[model samples]
Target: MLADIRSRLGGVAGINFGIGGPIAHRIDHLLSGARAGIAIKFSGENLRTLRDLAEEAQTRIAGIPGVTDVAVESQSEVPELGVHLDRERLARNGVSFAEAGLTLRAALYGAPVSRVYEGRNAYDLVLRVQEVAPDSIAMLERLPLRTDTGALAPLSAVATVTRESGPNIISRDQVQRKIFVTCNPAGRDVASVLADIRDAIDPLLEGKVGYAVHYGGQFESAAAASRRLLASGLLILLVIFGLLCMTFRNARDATFVMASLPLALIGGVAAVFLSGGVLSIASIIGFISVFGVAARNGIMLINHIRHLQSEEGVAGFEEAVWRGSVERVVPVLMTALTTGLALVPLVIAHDAPGNEIQSPMAVVIIGGLLSATVLNMVVVPALYLRFGRPVKNNGGAAGTPGETFL
Candidate 1:
């Protein structure tokens, strides 16, 4: 669709196209707003030089594959009608500068002379010369101006009227003039596209004094988000570990429980690979949720085994492990099944409205649950039997010694 639109608009000049995405995607961007595409900002004192550099950068970026809608954000030049005043000519003609300016303004854009009133309405009645084209230099030069001597003189006697080109709009950042060369990436990621853009424009910017180039837009936002997510993930893991240690009252048990996180991630990663293989923000969030669920399952099984020995008067450590695993099977299966079934719809309708982000997330969660549920039941039991410590009841009932769960 984008290619067809570009082809149709090929003949039109100075046009920029913005490609929109799903409604949910647009709403997400609106709520957490950021500029789209790659924006390279060039800042310098000289507008002409800055404009030239921006155009050159734009041309270089346009050659790169997957780049589209390449354009300079600021238009450097636009047609303008200029009236250059001659002070000497004005004094000789006894016409003040203000008088000549007023004459030209009145002829081009009429001034309000009086107000016309109806029963309940009032409108300005403007008076000025008619049948004169404001864009015609000849008509402007022939405009009559009042002189101090009570006589009329041609505007040409005090000023020269000509058409010229000047900057239409000037953009500034941090009190310095700047121009942006922006483009949208089609089939490539923002980082790779921006890297190619940097490589293409590096040579052109070498030794360019008093000028600086900065990259922004989607690339900037993505990079920042990646850093933040990394930090948050690490912090969350630490917090989860701390809570586990507090709950189990031993670091060994907590570490064992944390092992379920990696098990859960194995399925999550596989699911992402199966579903378009894109590790988006939604996928990361899914992984976080999966970690919590995996840890909770481990905690439930381990705590139940300890409870059977310490509180239920179980005879032996091996018996406690067996009975605990068998008893908790139903609860664990129910938890995993309910959550996975609920997310099945989202996973199937991945491309449906408002499901773009949630679908990938659902896939991760469902996959993680399948792996964590099976492994938590089997692996946690084997590991506990081999290494988990024996528990003693407050009532003086004790299990076999030298047995370690951690």
Candidate 2:
């Protein structure tokens, strides 16, 4: 039912709207942050300003299409202070840190001096030098300090009142102060939504402030992994082809085996489309399984053809190819079917919804195997028959005494 809706509504292209491009995060970093270098000041004031910006940014992000749950951090703060003590001036005025602190506390919040007890209730008439407690900077500065020589000095004489930022909890990565906002895409692929989020953010954040905003979520990790996976798969294919050539002593057999890969992938990609799914972790895993299984099926068919040509003294190449494919067909089909059946549970039962997971992998493998099984029978044999011409051997080193060559 869901598949039908997507089919009518623009197919996978509309779905691609949610996939993100690779360079989104790097671009985001360059725009929002001052520099990638070490920042000496990740102070409370700096972060508070960042949080305010983030809050505004978060609001803007929430309004964009396909975005949900926008949240940010970096809001560290100190108590709203009216600090009077200046460390430099205190030393010049003959005041120690503790001494200045004690005087300031006494003047601001005068201590209890007297208590009167009654039978039913205890009442205390405390005497404090200052009637109204000094809560404001102006009042606190008026606090009188008795110097060591019996001289009364205003706290203003020793300290300068200033409001400054402070630091609390700090977050870092690679020993560099780091901060980021997290968000979920609403019913969309992480990659596509990430792209949309970046586009919405770029204009608003071009000249925001000192800090930079980066998108670091599961999507980024998966996309990176996907690129690695592609490279790994290609590397595996090249290695396999090289190994096959060495084993068969002929590039012809190796080419036959490698040709099976394209058909195998066709089924995998088709399965993803059929299931109304994205190119997800599970799909990639399925691709891996498909490649391995398809390659194995091709190898089996190729090995059998090579075996028949050398061992059975098969004179005709087409006959050898036909006999080899016929022998391997049942086993290949059975292998493909058994594996496809094994993946049924994953395709049917989704442990976590909204994201294509192991189920898509199962789907891809099943579909790829379905296509590979048929192609392995026809494709591998055709390539072998075309190239496996009975090369004239002069009963010499070209055809080794007991060595089999395809």
Candidate 3:
């Protein structure tokens, strides 16, 4: 559909297509600080570089694969009629620039002299020139201007009115003049497309003084939120580690349980790759959740083995490991299956509106559970058997002659 529209509007200059409605655009602006799929910003004092660099960046971005509808933001050019006053001319005609400007404002632009109230609504009573105001320089040259001595003179005698183009609005960020090159992403992730855009433009813009480039739009929030979440994840891990140490009373036991985390990650990473290689906030949250569940399973397995050795009188390391693993197999599989199955519908409905956020999370959790449960049943027990020791009785080594160590 987009391709058809593009084809239909071929050769139309300065026209760029955009996706979504007003609300979506506003959301994009809120997320990215740019109201498009991508925003490449340029800043400088030179208007030429602002215009040239923005255009150049837009063109290069469009050339990159998966970039579409690239264009420099419009509304920067404004058609204005400038009245440049000549001081010598004004003095000779006994006219001041202020007086001439007031005359122009009152006559041509309809200055509001007073207001009239009709009930609750008030209307401006304007004063304007009756004769058709000049639309061209020739006509404006002949327009009358009031002088200080209460005389009238041709506006051309005191000033020059010329048609020119200027910015309707000047926008600044961090006290620097800025222009935005807006574009949409097609057939690719926003992050990859942004990288490509930067790659293509950075070298060309390198070594230029007083000019800088900024990227804005959805990726802005994505990058920031990802950074914060990563930090939070680290903190969560530290807290989890501390809690595990308290629970087990042995650093080695805690470390062995945490070791199973990598096993869980294998499936989660595979799921992300298989579903869509996008790592969103939802996906990160899912990984965090995965850590908790994976840790629980590891703790459950290790604790059961300890119980068998200390309470159930399981004789050998291999026998205790096998018995504990077999005892917990049903419970571990049940827990993992129930959680994964509950998210199956979301995983299937990948294209639903809100599912964009939920689906990745579901996929990650489900995949992590599958691998974590299997590894908990197999690898975790092996780790425990290798590292764990049975509780000592009054006699050391269970059957040796009475001996104790401090």
RMSD of each: 6.1, 10.6, 5.2
Model 3 agreement with the true structure over 1-406: per-residue lDDT tens digits = 7688766765776666676669869988876566787888888898767888887887777779888777776755767777888999999999888888887776667888799999999999988764545457777777787787888899888887899887776778889998888888877778898888889888767888989888888787788899999999899887887887766666667787888888889989999998868787899899989888999888888777767766667778788889889998888888898888999999999877767788889999999998898877888888777876654332222231222221
* Clashes in predicted model 1: 7
What lDDT score belongs to each candidate, Candidate 1 first? 0.81, 0.67, 0.80
Task: List ranges where model 3 is wrong by over 4 Å.
Answer: 1-15, 21-23, 32-34, 43-51, 76-79, 86-104, 110-134, 142-158, 165-178, 203-211, 274-276, 315-318, 337-355, 392-406
Per-prediction TM-score: 0.68, 0.65, 0.77
> Which residue pairs in candidate 3 have backbone atoms (N, alpha carbon, C) closer than 3 angstroms, thus clashing?
32-217
Q: Which 10 consecutive residues of model 3 have the lowest summed lDDT?
A: 397-406
Per-residue lDDT tens digits of candidate 2, residues 171-238?
Answer: 66555555556554546666777677667666655665545655555665577789999899889888
At residue 275, give the lDDT of candidate 2. 77
* Candidate achieving higher lDDT, 2 or 3: 3
| Ordered list by TM-score, greatest first | 3, 1, 2
Task: List ranges where model 2 is wrong by over 4 Å.
Answer: 1-45, 64-66, 74-79, 83-139, 143-180, 227-235, 351-356, 388-406
Residue pairs in collision within model 1? 387-404, 387-405, 388-404, 388-405, 388-406, 389-404, 389-405
